[model samples]
Target chain A: MSIAFFAAFFLAWQYSIVWFDIPRYILTPPSVIVTKGWADIDRLLYYTWITGVEVVLGYAVAVILALPLGLAIAFSSILRRTIYPFVVCVEMVPKIAFAPLFISWLGFGLLPKVIIVFLVCFFPIVLNAILAFSSLSEELSRFSVSTGASVWRTFVKVRLPAALPQCFVGFKYAAINATVGAAIAEFIGSDQGLGFYIQIVTGNMRPDLAFAGIFFLTILGLALFGLVTLAERLLIPWHISVRHQSR
Target chain B: MNPLIELTGVQKVFGAGPGALHAFGPVDMKIEKGEFVSLLGPSGCGKSTLMLMIAGLLDATGGRIAIDGRTVVGPQTDIGIMFQDNTLVPWRTVRGNIELQLELRGLSTAAHRASVDELLASVHLEDFQRRYPHELSGGMQQRAAFCQALVHQPATMLLDEPLGKLDAMTREAIRTDLQALWIQRHPTVVFVTHSIEEAIQLSTHVAIITPRPGRVERIISVDLPYPRDFEVKSSPQFIGYVRQAQEIFRGYGVL
Candidate 1:
């Protein structure tokens, strides 16, 4: 169903561009984008790999840092009261405002792009992790204690697994934000990556190549999202949301 | 021998000062070892509050609750609890949930495998042991919960409406299973329920309680034989006991 819709939309796009006599430099047709993509497959793949690496690495770093920080905050009222407001304050600032600062400190290389991605993706992971841990059912906690489970046992056996489904919600959001962060960082200043490639091609009046880079970015975002979903299925098959989905 | 569970002047108040709400009790009760006692009351009667105190999940504003001669300062290893909700961890299989008791007690998987299997067999859920809680029917989930409570072999079980959420047929089936299980294990059980019939059907004694600022209105001995089956529900003696309980509730303005 979705495939047919996209196919028809592409045909309309192709015909409308020709019928309106739109200049190729402004809005390239689907055929032109595809031809450009095919002709520059090697270059596209190379730059796509760079952006993909930045996104995955930044997302991985964000999850690693956010989970423990979230747990610490959730477990302790002192930390939650002190750190949570500061986190919200920092999150409220426009993340793009940090791009120039990051580039200046880390230079116009992959480091700045990855850091920007990490900054963009960090808040959701932390917030979701905190919410997941804190929102565990009181009944489960009571049952755990009544069964004589130690604090550590309750955390590992009950709390951690219970938090997984909500944590995956953050992961999905972070996956998409990861690509956008990488792209925004590259747009500001970078030497290599899909975003850099698009900037170069568009400046040189090659919308076809620019559109090709965009197509690859969309695929990258989707693939990363798919990976997060796959991990969720593997880790929490017993979750109500996931269980019903299978049926 | 001392009573398995003893409560003297137990009470709970939700807050302090002028706004304080007296939730339940200035009540005393006792159950001998291996007895089935039902706490019968109306909605909002604080029956569950009393159970929580006995399980050491909540503190009484005043008075004492002791199990096996030890005061319940906090949740103890020797007591098992099941609430109205199944409380099954969603990410675990039926077998996995049952094994949680053993795991929490520091028993390794290899050591507890046989016991877990036996628990599943007893509940007739051996075939569905690998299924997750959401995949099972309500009765099955309750059965799995019962196994989770029993697997650790606690000497006393505190159940707060454990089977209250099931359909009538499912409830009857699980009640039968519970009776059979109880006969075999003989754990001292304090079951909280609003159903007078349920209280009489299972318990050796029924502790009838009044609403908010709940007190033990009366205690009635069931005097029914063990291994009770569905036929007991239709028996004239059972009807007499139900009538006696209803009259008490009527006097208390609860019926």
Candidate 2:
């Protein structure tokens, strides 16, 4: 960690004028993203927390709602016929175009931002879940049901495990979607968050702080992705990817 | 004792249109308790379809399938089935696969621990109990499948070409193991296979069916006694039976 920090420090110190030509505006240089990242640390921490909460809550809501809905669309021919087309229609609708209307109805509150994030992140989970469920090999399904498994049991025991790999694909996509959704929500409304900070600072032409805000959002997205990857590993250790990694 | 299973006028038809296909026909069959019967037919001859109907995985368009005089409307816990593919869930270990029936019955894990171990030992898979299906060879996977079918101690077992995936040597070895396991469990068994020699080696009765829109062409009883050996394959008795079954197939224009 120290070596990486010094290397970055050494390179930035050697070439600060080349990277950020605005002398007065450059502030403390690459070191400042960390130092001011600490000085405005409270604001940094606050917005980070808000955006983190929004991303997590929005992603959680998407998963909770997506799972059963996805399972239904994947497993039941009737439900798939009834609801899948409508889901696709809603998913294709431009979520960003509704930002002004969301602010108007939801009153520039956290609720609007969360709703936007949910809208953006929900589709992948549902679509991937459906795909995963559909992809289960027929023989496995037959085996479970023939062994006296009820429909629900067959789904839980056989279908769910079979779908986990695809579900992870959905989760990975949702994590990125959550961050972008949170940023867009903060762009339109909200008093605080990395997205809010980015919008406010960028309007006043504080590109350095804007870049910092962008940096934190990237970190948050990466962290969420890392958590999901950890979960995937735990849930399916026998999976080829996990098995190969272990070896 | 009365026969363990009866299939009367069983028929299966697919789709409804001018181009609709008929894969099987109305047929009558019976298997005594503890007997191994083979429904021998080529692919699409409705052998697997017949097995599915008897397993209660599919409904018959015409006729009844009964287990010990009880009509089968849907799958019953007393009947276990295995398909041609090794259907072990890739996520489950060998022991977990075998314990699936017990899990369905909501049998306490503690209650079945010893039995699960016994089945693993019987399939000669005790050492690989913790290994996943993908970790096992094709033969091991099929053995795990067989163990899973018999785990709940079903009164009858339906095997749809269970050893079809293995190589010739593994196929022979598994066939031997399957026969031994069948005797040990003593479940009335119906196995579907295209191999004439397999039918001769494994079955008390071999029922040959004609091609698509299949019907029973002949039912050849192998009066030769049980615990059949490899030598039985080269015997005059076996040769005679094979020739007769072949003639029946020839009559149906299947050979």
Candidate 3:
């Protein structure tokens, strides 16, 4: 159904082009996008890999740092109360504005892009981890304790497992945000990557090439989203999200 | 045996100041090995709280609670607990959830294999061992939870309304299974429930509790024979017992 809808829309859009000359770059036809994409395939792949690496590395770091930090915040009331408000404050501020600052600090290397991705991705992972941990049933907590489970045992065995579904939820959003943050950082400061390609092409008024760059970026985002969804299905098959996906 | 479990002048107070309250009795109780006792009370009577205290999940504000002569400074390894709600981790399969205790103990699979298989067979969950919690019905999940509670073979079983969430027909089915399982293991069971019929049907002795500061109102012995069926509910003795429990509740002005 979705494919059919898109096919019909493309046909209509192509037909309208004969009657009105849409700008060559901004609204490049599907045919031009395909041709340009194939022509620049090698360059596109190279830049895509670079951006993809930054996004993945940043996301991996965020998960590693956030899981333990979030667990600590969730486990200790004192830490949560003292630190969570600061986290919320940082989360509310627009992270895009910090792109230039990161560029200046880290220079034109991959460091700025990776840091930006981490900044954008960490909040959801941390917040969801805290929420999931906080929402664990007290009755179950007591049951674990009475079963002779030590504090550490109770956490890994009971509390952590219980929080997993929620953690995946945050992870899904974080993965997507990580890709976008990386692309934006590339746009702000970089001689390479898909984001820089699009910025330079659009500046040169070659919308078709710019649209092709965007097409790759969209594919990257979709691929990242697909990867997260696939992991969620494999790891948390019992979660309602997976059940809903099967439906 | 000198009481395997003892609670001396145990008091549990909740909150502080004007909102502060006492949930259960300054309980003084003793249970010998292998006794099946029920803590019966109306809703809000704190029967659940008492069970939790005995399970070492909660502390006694007033006096000492000891299990097998050891002070319960914290949660003990020799106790197993089942709550009214199915607390199984939904993401884990039945076998995974059942093996949780053994895993926490860091027991090797080779060592605990026979015990795991026995528990699965005893609970009739061998076929469904790989199934997730959501895949099972309400009754089935509760049965799985029961098996998980007993997988470690603790000396005492503290059940807080384990069957309270099931429908009538499912409740009846599980109650029968529970009785058979109880007879086989014979762990010193302390069950808390608000239902008079359920208490009479399962317990060897019923400890009726008062409303707030839930002290024991009475302890009625159920000397009925074993292998009793659901048909026994229609008997004159069963009716008389139920009525007596109701009267005990009324005497406390609870009903």
Compute fnat per model. 0.81, 0.58, 0.72
Whole-model Cα lDDT per candidate? 0.90, 0.84, 0.85
Candidate 1's C-alpha runs over 4 A off are: A244-247
Residue B185 of model 1: what lDDT? 89
DockQ of all candidates, in order?
A: 0.73, 0.52, 0.63
For model 3, how does the per-residue alpha-carbon lDDT over B1-255 read when each residue is reduced to its tens digit? Answer: 669889898888999789989787788888778888899998888898888778777887888888888878777667788887867888789988888767766656567778888888876788999999988998889889998888888889999999888899998888888888888889999998888988888888888888888998788888776655767877899888899999988888888
Best by DockQ: 1
Q: Which candidate number has the best lDDT?
A: 1
Error of 1 at A34 (Å): 1.6
Give per-residue CA lDDT, model 2, range A141-197, as digits (tens). 666667676777776777778899999899889987899998888888788899999
Enumerate residue pairs that collide in model 1: none
State which docking tier applies to candidate 2: medium
**Clashing residue pairs in candidate 2 (N, C-alpha, C atoms within 3 angstroms):** none
Cand. 2 TM to true fold: 0.89
Say which prediction, candidate 2 or candidate 3, comes out ahead on DockQ: 3
Please give each candidate's TM-score.
0.96, 0.89, 0.92
The positional error of residue A113 in candidate 3, measured at the CA in angstroms, is: 1.8
Chain B alone, TM-score of each model?
Answer: 0.97, 0.94, 0.95
